[model samples]
Target: MARPGVPAPPPEPPRVGITLQQLRQSQGLSLDELSRKAGVSKSMLSQIERNQANPTVAVVWRLATALGVGVGELLGDGRPAPPAIVTVPAHGTPTLKSPDGKCELRILGPIDLAGEFEWYELTVQPGGALESEAHEPGSREHLSVLAGTLEVSAGSDTSRLKAGETARYAVDLPHAIRNTGKTIASALLVVLHAA
Candidate 1:
């Protein structure tokens, strides 16, 4: 309850689950068709839609890429999609969302498609998770935890990365980056592309 002089806190943000369904529907694809394209099980996809399951970042990325959308689209605000070519300035770049809803992403630089890979910084709030779906073929990712602790899940493996620790995994493996620590967390993600 708000005091007469104090204002009430903002309402909780809506939970974001399986915005993937929106992507699938927008693309006119059946769950099975999307399953085939994303290499995710239809049952799993169904669970994700219903919020019964949380897909790893790899799985999430793959689905988004198959749908030809940004990872944010799969984990999103359900807004109308804009044109191709998303240009984010040094100060105003779009974010890669965390499903746990406790983190904020800052896009620091341009996506260098000309190079073999790109990098981004992710700042995680206490109890936040960034579940990035899988990426396209031949792509991989490398992450280094900068502060606090993080839970890194890739494919069937899951590990905790403390400060200064790093791990690299295939982008096709459903992956998730989660802040398991009580304090704030940050990480550097290096995305590598396949030739």
Candidate 2:
């Protein structure tokens, strides 16, 4: 089975059809609804959920974002979380880049806190910005600037924070963080979810 100068194909990702279908149903989302939310075609989603097709990474990411779950969760065994202190090394943390690719958010929270709360180490390149949609009602976000300056806008209000400064605001409405400074900006963001 060895081919000269040829690499073996990568193994397939875990089948996620059943898990995707179950999650959609549990969330009371119809194929059309999920399609609209995830920006994927209904036919493609149907195919993926039926295991008829292996989705691309972009598709999986869109679906995961719509489902409010991580890609790992989508591909993982659905198991109840066990009580334990989780440690994530900097290099091992998952990072998501903004659509523009100018900002990066490193997930710094444990998996168990996924939907309820999250912590992120956010890095914004000069003139970069991270915009977010509205979260669940009563959700709040706290940001502590570690370097440079940041401009934060929540709903109709906007504020600026410099290094060593902190800002807390309601995130139930649209929010954004922009690095208006010439240098790169880094910050720690903590999101507290509503019960």
Candidate 3:
């Protein structure tokens, strides 16, 4: 498939181990801590970070998840940065489904805001609930219902919000949002991280 007098494309560079090490350190995570969060053995992670071992796809996936980054961010070519203006179409947005499969959340914010903050469009089927564990201290969540009715509960207090209603609550304690109406519930949710 080569054209006359044209050179073949250069091969991809070898994976750089420093990327992983830097990310872990920047997050103030030790090898043991990252191992526990990634579900990978500490020894294996050590090896990978030292370029002594080649990680499998699953291992890389777990590491990416633990680092709160995409796998491409780890293996991307070490080239100059591109322009800052980025666009994410609706079809390209990342989505997460609840464990029970009755709720869906579409990430609407930039990926760089993963930890500091996040925005999402959440949809819950009737009779479904989205339960969440306590977030970082001082973190809060704001939800504005766009359709149907939602029961927002934080700890012992619960409130009902209908279409065009909004509620803000501290998320440092266990919380849940249940769709109490017979129709699907849609809401815009913004989570602010603790300073």
How many Å off is the CA of 118 in candidate 2? 0.7
Task: Report, for every candidate in turn, its global Cα lDDT versus the true structure.
Answer: 0.78, 0.90, 0.88
lDDT of 2 by residue, 1-195 (tens): 759899888877777788888888867899999999999999999998898987888998999999888898777664312324445577899999998898999999887999799999999999999999999999999999999999999999999999999999999999999999999999999999999
| Deviating ranges (above 4 Å) for candidate 3 | 1-85
What does candidate 1's lDDT look like per residue over 1-195, in tens digits? 899999899975433354766667767899899899999999998988777887888987888888888777666775537545555566576676655568766655565553476777888897788776787777888889999999988888998989999988887767888887899988888888787
User: 178 in model 3: Cα distance from truth in Å?
Assistant: 0.5
Ranking by TM-score: 3, 2, 1
**TM, every model:** 0.48, 0.56, 0.57
Q: How are the candidates ranked when ordered by lDDT, highest leading?
A: 2, 3, 1
State how far residue 176 of model 3 sits from its true place (Å). Answer: 0.4
Best by TM-score: 3
Best by lDDT: 2
Model 2, residue 46: C-alpha shift (Å): 52
Regions of candidate 1 where Cα sits further than 4 Å from its true position: 1-94, 112-116
Looking at model 2, the pairs that clash are: none
Q: Candidate 3 residues 102-149, lDDT tens each? A: 999999998888878999999999989999999999999999999999
